[model samples]
Target: MTHVVTESCINCKHTDCVEVCPVDAFHEGPNFLVIDPDVCIDCIACVAECPVAAIYVDSDVPASQRQFLALNAELARDWPVIVRKREPLPDAAHWADVTGKIDHLQHP
Candidate 1:
């Protein structure tokens, strides 16, 4: 199963997880990241790297965040792959522990 990048990653946009992705399954957006389901190998390498605990196996995605599974797939189709670690958003630390960030998501 593929891993999903959930709403907790919204404003934070941490890239630590991407550095551990063996398949380069991560895609970067303006303020978020997604995992290309087709490219993920289910290695689970990136999950622990997420400081916000935003990554999850598809089957284990929380019911409230299930939409992220499909969202990751959809966004990955157009976003460019991110293969290295980078600085998070300017306000990452402030957003990391905040919940219900779906409304703050920035597409593309």
Candidate 2:
């Protein structure tokens, strides 16, 4: 199973999890991050490092944010490897831009 980056991550865009992921499975999102299910290895290194506790195994994803499970897989197919992820402050000031954008970025 894959890990899901939940809505909690929307404003809590800390990138430390990305820093520890070994497979380069993490991808950039407008206000958060997405994990590549195919490459994740279910290592869960990202989950423990997430300060806000935004990451979860797919089966444990909260009902409201289930869409992210699909979003991750869809985005993974095309997301580039992140060579140097950095810690980021909460994007509370700019989260208005994240809504509905994932629907437009699909996997080929």
Q: What is the lDDT of residue 39 in candidate 1?
A: 97
CA displacement after TM-score superposition, residue 65 of candidate 1 (Å) = 0.0
Return the lDDT, model 2, position 105: 35
lDDT of 1 by residue, 1-108 (tens): 889999999989899998888889999998999999999999999998999999999999999999998899999999999998899999999999999889888884
TM-score of each: 0.97, 0.75
Error of 1 at 1 (Å): 0.7
Prediction RMSDs, each to the true structure: 0.8, 4.2
Candidate 2: tens digits of C-alpha lDDT, residues 56-98: 9999998877888987787666667564666574554464345
Off by over 4 Å in 1: none
CA lDDT scores, all candidates in order: 0.93, 0.73
> Which lDDT value does model 2 have at 83?
43
